[model samples]
Structures are given as structure tokens and as C-alpha cells.
Target chain A: MTTTIEPRSGTAFKLGKGQFLEVVDPQGQQVSDLLAFNAHDTAEVISNGRTFDYADTIYLTTGHVLYSNRSNRLLEIVRDDVGTHDFLLTPCSQDTFRLLYDELEPHQGCFGNLAGVLAPFGITEDEIPCAFNCFMNVPVDGKTGKFSVEAPLSKAGDTIVFKAMMDVIIGLTACSAPKSNNGSFKPIDYIIHDHLDDVA
Target chain B: MTTTIEPRSGTAFKLGKGQFLEVVDPQGQQVSDLLAFNAHDTAEVISNGRTFDYADTIYLTTGHVLYSNRSNRLLEIVRDDVGTHDFLLTPCSQDTFRLLYDELEPHQGCFGNLAGVLAPFGITEDEIPCAFNCFMNVPVDGKTGKFSVEAPLSKAGDTIVFKAMMDVIIGLTACSAPKSNNGSFKPIDYIIHDHLDDVA
Candidate 1:
């Protein structure tokens, strides 16, 4: 099945073991937040710390495995068009917005989107874990270890695919950074397929 | 109300605004993991990063306010006998135990206790946030910027009192580090009281 996640919005879908979920940047310069939870047990959700530790790299690309807090493998990256994905930053939230910009008006962000989309599955706001920012340009300065958000390196139609290591629920949000986007914020598309099917 | 959390176990309770919860190390040398979530909305749980950022210190003590991920005030430390506490480390889990040691038998840990205690309140394991380790001695070396878990500095009868900023649910687990503890792990006590009462 295929779906288009609108800008500043998110969707949740179940990906069975051995299935593939392809996240595509339908338009270049856009970023998406990807979060996953074990379908059978939500406590075992995607953990950035474990993923980074297991992968031994800050940046993720094809052949990397997304690990849960339990150190269990959740997904294995099978394909990647853009190699610069971020696992360091938390999803943008209202609190972060106010902290960074002093803005009061509620802006659409990943935290709210993840909360809204996962509510039906009994997932609440507190359950939202740190997400993997696919196609997001957050570079860490070597000298100061400071991270800066930048425009994505992906081109239009760039995609990354992950094969599920277990039955899992995947959440995706088209990042909503009105001020940070280089020019425009755009939507992204996702496709889930059976591993045995050779769609490529 | 008063409660005792057995060693290697945990319990959950609700604290309303204008109320205080006192966590006591009945027999010193015991550590406990304290985790809180918004009673009305779970998403606004206590966040270690925000609390550290707001306090501008690595150690927590009397008068420090615990902040949630949303930057909302969750708890205020009104009284403390042991000023040392940990906000850097996550609750120990089976995954972490196996990673660090080759131990095959599943030993009791904070993560399991939190999950078990909060299950009745509909909090799944995924919802368990990074905890505030009370009475735990985790010291960081300034020069190398490395943290080492040491024996707790708190003595028997040491206590910390937190005033609820809002209606919140708290989960506490007595540390169950069989081999890591200097000697042995022990149970702790807790008491909830209304701020208007002077029961002391």
C-alpha cells in the first residue's frame, strides 16, 4: 500500500516482518521523521542511542539497522538515495519551538503529528520516542559539537527503504519547519511492499 | 498515604497539585528511579534534558524544578537530605544488562519494574520515560567528561520531597543491581501528603 503524508502531518501503518517500507522525498529539500514501535509490545520502540551504538556511526544509510531500546533489530535499511540522515535530533515540538524562537502561536510539528496519528493505536503523546529524521540536514560541527539544521541533500524522488525485522508500527511526519525550510516545505510519500515482491 | 517499594520492585501513584511525595531511603545505600507523567496527558512526562537545561546543572537538589519535554513544570524539590541525584543515565533494562555483561539470566531492573507498576495505569513499556535516579551516586569526571556509577552518598533516613506542579502520576523502582551495588540492594519508603498539612 502507498500513502502520501501531508506537510506537518503524519500517518501510522503496520509493517509485518520481512516487509519493506519505502519513504520517499517526493520533493527535494523536505525532511520526514520516522518512528517505529514493535506491534506486539510498544515498550520496545526505536531507540536512537542503541541505533547509533550498534551502527557505530552518527549518520545512517543503506545497510544500517534500526535498533530498539532492547537492542533488538527493528528494521534494516535496504536502499538509500540520500545517505545523510539524522539520528541525533528529537522531533520538533511546541516546547522546542518556544525555546528556540520565543514564538507563542502553536505551529504544526512532528510531536503533535505523532501524537495525533498514533492515538488510535492507544499510543499517547508520552509514548512518542525520538525519531529518525530522514533526509533532514542536521550537521554536527566537529570543533564545538554543535548541530545546525540545513536543507536536505536529497533530490526529488529520492527514497530510502527499510525491511522490517519484526511486525512493527511505523509513524512518519513531513517535517514542519516554516522558518528553517530553504524555500518551501513539501509533502512526502511512502510505500509498503512484501519483501518477496521484486518491485524494483 | 504511605507505601513501601520492595527491592527490585516498583509501584505507581498519583499526586495532585499542592501535594508532596517524599521518597525515603529507609536503609541507605539504596537507589530509586522516579518517573512522572502528566495525569491528564501522558505525553508531557518528565524530561531529563529539559530539567538539566532549566536547572543549568548536572546534579539535582533542593529547589530544583523538574521540567517535562514540553518544558512544563512537573515537580519542585521542596526538601532534600541527600542532594546528589542522577539525570544522565537511563533506567537499566535487560537489553543493556546483556550488552554490558554476558549474564543470561534476566535479573530484575528498573525498566521491568516501571513497566509492571505502570501497566495498571495503561502505561506500556514504551511510555516509560528516562527516569530521575534519586539517591544514586553517578559521578562524572570533569576532565574526561565521563560518568561512573559509584556508591550512593545518602545515608539511612535520607529523603527527598517533591511538590507536584500539576496532577501527575509517579512511578518508583527500588534499584535491583545485584552485582553493581557495593553490597546489596534494599527497599525504600514513600509518603504522600497534602501541602497544607503539617504531619511532621
Candidate 2:
């Protein structure tokens, strides 16, 4: 069944091994933060450091595998239309707004959304690691080693698919941070497909 | 007073505002992992994301400021001998050795050491965030965003100094990973000096 996650909100659900998760960008420039954890053991969650160590590139795309904290293969990027992504940032939080923005009303960012949804699965805010940001643009300067977040390069109808390598719990968000979504927010659409063996 | 952190060991201490912390590479080619937290509130710790966002550079050096999770100024780099450092990596742990190395004995890495010392200060293993890796070298590809951990460039007696911008608890280590120190581990030396105001 297809599911729509409203803007600035998030959800966590179980995904079986070999299932394919399709994340679609219904509107251009919207960013989504994705995370995966072993369903049997929440401690073994997605690790950007491990993934980057093996992938040999931060600009991950189709064919790259995501690794867990314990170095187990978690998911594989089976398909991707928007190749630009970010792996260096922690999910933005309430403190992010207090620190970076001057608005009178502060919005709890993606970290808050993820934390609220993942709590049911026994995960805490402090346990949230660096997220696999789908369709986010962050470019780093070679000489200065500085980086900045820019508008995503994804267009409307862009989609990315991840094939689960193990039974996992996934935390996903329609990113709430304004800068991450080019100063706007929009819902994200996704659907899951089970492998033939699981169906049988 | 001068304190020497034995090879692959770590320590934690209290640092008052305006105090100067001088971390020295007693021998060349060693790396140190440093972390800071607000003394009054452990929840407000050093944040690489915030520091990088405001400093506009990941190659932190003299004149750069390290920011806390709450966006408070924590430390200012007052002096530097080796300019290259890493802020993108979590402290290496036993899992790191198990996954990346083939050693018969997997030493609990810097993460273990930091957890041991910082626990007394009310900080837990999960609370430990990305560290300021002193003297470590990690160069990222501008195009690929992939980075590799390289041997440190610090020479014997090389020193880097930071002036605390707030009263903080500090966790520091003489790194255990062979790759960070060019296959050899050595001691790290440090000294703390109080400001004139503190003395008065």
C-alpha cells in the first residue's frame, strides 16, 4: 500500500529482508531523511561513517550499499533518479533553530519528528545517528574543507529505491528544516514491494 | 601541571572559562580525540555541525571557534602548530576494530576510553558525539565527497592551544587506531593554564 507522510512529520515502521522501499518526491526540491536499524536489535543501526568508509564516496547513488554500526549490510540502493545527497549532517533539531534562526517561533526539526516516531520502537533522541539524506545537496570545498547546504537537485516525480538487506526498522521524515527543503515543505510519498519468496 | 596520556589511553577533566588547554604531540605522528561539554549541563555538548555551520570551514585552525549544541561558544583555537584535524568521525570503538581490522586482539578504541573517564562526569556512551580529532588527517574528495583517514602531520613538540569560552568538561584521548597514527601509537602531552582573571 502507498503511504503519504505529511510535511514536517515522520514515521517508523518495519521492513522485512529483501523488501524494496520506493521513496518518491511528488514535488521538486523536498528533502527526506532516512534511517535503518536492525529489527531484532535496535543497537545495530545505520552508520554513515561505516558506509562512507566502504562506499569510498559521500555522493552515494545506485549500486552503493548502506552498512550498519556493526558493519553488517543493511540496505542497497537499487535505483535512484536524484543522485545528490548528504551524509555528514545529524538530523536537525530544536536547538538548530535556536542557534541558527531568529524566528520568534521555533519548529522542532527532523530530529524531533524522527525521535517522536521512533520512540515506540525503543529508540531515544540521543540514539539518532547521522541520517541518509535523500535528495539533499551539500557541497564541500576541496581546498578549505568547508561545506554548505543548497537546494536539492531532484525534480518532481524523482524516485529512489532501497532494497533491504536485513529485517529492519526504518525511520523516515519529510524534513522540517526550512533550509533543507529550499525554504518550503511538502509531503513525501512511498510504497513497499515484497520479494517473490516473501509473497509465496 | 603537565599530564601525559599514555599511548592509546584517555582522560577527562574540568576546564573553567578563559583557561588555556595546550595539547602537545610529545612524539610525532600521534592523533588525539578531544570532546567538550558544558559543565553545568552535560546535554549541551560540543557540536561539529554547529561549529562547521558557523565557522564555514571543516579544516579548523587558529582563530576558529567551536560551538556547543545550544549554539554557545565553547572554545576558541588560540594557537595551532598542525592545522589539519578531523571533525566528521565518531570516536573509534571496539566495533570499529572488529569491522575494519584483522587483529587477533581488538582493543576497545578511543570511544571505550572516553566512555570510561567521562562516565564519572555523568556522560554516557550514547551521549558522546563527534569528536575534534586533533592532529588527525582526513582529506575528502571535492567531487566524490569520499574521505580517507591519513597519518597525522604533527611533529615532535607540536602544539595546539584552545581557550575555553565556557566552563566545560573535557574528554581527550591518545588515539588507538593505527591508521590515525601511521601504524604507531604514542603518548599525548597536555597542560592547562588559568587566565589572569581566574588567578586573581
Candidate 3:
């Protein structure tokens, strides 16, 4: 199944074991926050901290495994068009914008988008975990120990794919941080393909 | 309702808005990991990063608010018998034990207890975010930039209370890190009181 998450919006879909989900950055300079939860158990959701510890890298690319809080592998990155993805930062929220930019306007953020999209699954805002920011440019300065977000390096149609290790629920948000990029947001597409039959 | 979670075990319960949950270290010297999820929306669950940033303190005490990923307030610490709490570390998992101790035997850890306790609620390991390590003595050294876990300072019957800002599901794990404390673990009790009726 395929889905398109519009700018400032979010969507959720299920990927059975042996299935692969490919997320496409339809337009360059857009960041997508991807979160996943064990379909059989909501408590076993993706954990950025564990993933980083397991991979021993701040940046994620193909071959990296997204580990859950229990240190279990949930998804494995099987393909990537853009090699850089951020697993260190939490999703952008209203408070982040308010505290950093002092902009009081109700701007769209990944927090709200994830909450809305997962609500149908009986998931609430408090259940939202840190997400993997794909196609976003966040560079760390080794000398000063500082990091800054820049425009994405991916071009149109750039893609990243992950194979589900178990039945899982995936949530994606087309980040609406206008200032993070070129003062505009764009949509992203995702496709989930089942390969269980082939494995059988 | 009241529940006593045995040492190295866990329990999950829900508290409505205006209700308060009190956790008591009946035997003292015990560390408990407290995790909260928005009962209405799990995606906005408590976030240690946001809470620390909001309170501007590494330690949690009375009057501090536990903020969610969406930056929404989830719970407020209305009372604290032991003022020190660690919000900087993730719960200990089997992987952590293996990596640190190199002991291959099955060891009890906060991650497993949480997953088991919240299983009935469909919560899995991935949903367990960085926890508020209640009564756990993890002190950071300013000179060496190092921290070590020590035995808790709280005495028997020491208690901490949190008033729910929203409907919330709380998970508590009696940490099973034997070496972190004395050579054994102790149980903890929790009581939930509905204050909404009193308010009305």
C-alpha cells in the first residue's frame, strides 16, 4: 500500500513482518519524522537512544537497525538514497518553536501531526516517542560540540527503505518547520510492500 | 486503588485528571522508574528532555512539571519526600547489563519489568521513554564529568506524589540493578486518590 503525507500532516500504516516500507522525499529540503511501534505491543516502540547505542553512530544510513527500548531490532534500513539521517533529536513541537523562535503563531510541527495520525489507533500525544528525522540536515561540530539544522541534502524522489523485523505500526510526519529549510514545506510519499509470501 | 509492585517487577495504572498518585518506598533504598503516558493520547507521553529543559534542572522535585513530547503538561509533582530524582538516563535493559557487567545470566532490569507490567495495556518496550529514576542515586561529578549510581538516600516510607494534569497511564518498575544499590532489591507501593470529586 502507498500513502502520501501532505506538508504539515501525518499518516500511520502497518507493515507486517518481512515487509519493507520505502519513504520518498518527493521534494527536496523536506524532513520526515518516522516513528514505529510493535503492532502486537505498543510499549515496544522505536527507541532512538537504543538505536544509536547499537549502531554506535550519530547518523543513520543503510544497514543500521532501529532498535526498540528493549534493545530488540524493529526495523533494518535496507536502502537509502540520502546517506544522512538524524537519530539524535526529538520531533519538533510547538514548545520548541515557541522557546527557540519566540513565534507565538500556531505553526505546524511533527508533534501535533503524529498525535493526530495515531489517534485512530488509540494512541495519544504522550505515547509519541522520539522520531528518526529523515532527509533533514543536522550537523554536529566535533570541536565545539554544537549542532545546527540545515536544509536537507536530498533531491526530489530521494528514498529510504526499511524492512520490518516484526509486525509494526509506522507513523510519518512531513515536518512543517519552515525556518529549518527554505521557508516552505513539502509532502512525502511512502509505500509498504509485503514479501512474506516470497520468504515462505 | 493501591498496588504493591514486588522487587524487580512492575505495575501499570491509570489516573484521571485531578487525581494524584503517590509512590512509596516502603523498604527504602529502592529505586523506581516512573513512566507516564497520556491516557487519552499515548503519542504525547512524558519526555525527560522537555521536562528538564522546562524546569531548567537535572533533578526533579516538588513543584516541577513532567512535560510530554508535545510540550504539554502531563503530571505535577505535588509532594516529594526524597527530593532527588534522575531524569537523564534511560531505564536499564538486558543489553545494558550484558554490556556493562559481562554476566551472561538472565538478570532483572527495569526494561523487562516495564514491558511485562504494561503488556496488559498493550504497551511494549519501545514505548518506554527515558524514565524518572525515583530515589536512585546517580550523582554527576563536576571535576571528572563522570557520574555513578549509588544507594538511594531515601528512608523507609519515603514518598513522592504527582497530580495528574491529564488522564494518564503510569508504569512503575522497581529497578533490579543489584549492584547499583545494596546487594538486594526492595518493593514499592503506590496509591491513587481521586481528587476531582473533592474539587467538585
lDDT minimum window of 10 residues, candidate 1 chain B: B139-148
- Report the lDDT of model 3 for residue A25: 86
Give one digit per residue, the lDDT tens place, for model 1 in B1-200.
Answer: 66889888888889998799999888888888899999998767887655653564557788889988777899999898988887655677776667655578866578888888888878777666668889877664433233456788889888899999999999998887653355587998999988635425
For candidate 3 chain A, which ten residues in a row score worst on lDDT?
A: A138-147
Give per-residue CA lDDT, model 3, range A55-106, as digits (tens): 5455778888998877788999988899877665667777777876678796
* TM-score on alpha carbons, each prediction: 0.66, 0.87, 0.62
Per-residue lDDT tens digits for candidate 3, residues B1-200, read 55788888888888899888888888888988999988876655778756754664556788899988777899999888888777656777788778656777857588888888877777665667888888887665422223566788889999888899999989898888775456688898888877623311
Separately for all candidates shown, the number of backbone clashes (residues 3 or more apart, or on different chains) is 3, 0, 26
**Residue A152 error for model 2, in Å?**
1.2
Predicted candidate 2 versus true structure: per-residue lDDT over B73-138, tens digit per residue: 999998899999988776888867876776678898899999999999999876777799999999
Q: lDDT for each of the candidates?
A: 0.78, 0.86, 0.77
**What are the candidates' individual DockQ scores?**
0.10, 0.43, 0.12
DockQ score for model 2, please? 0.43
lDDT of 1 by residue, A123-147 (tens): 7776676688898776654333334
Candidate 3 falls in which docking quality class?
A: incorrect
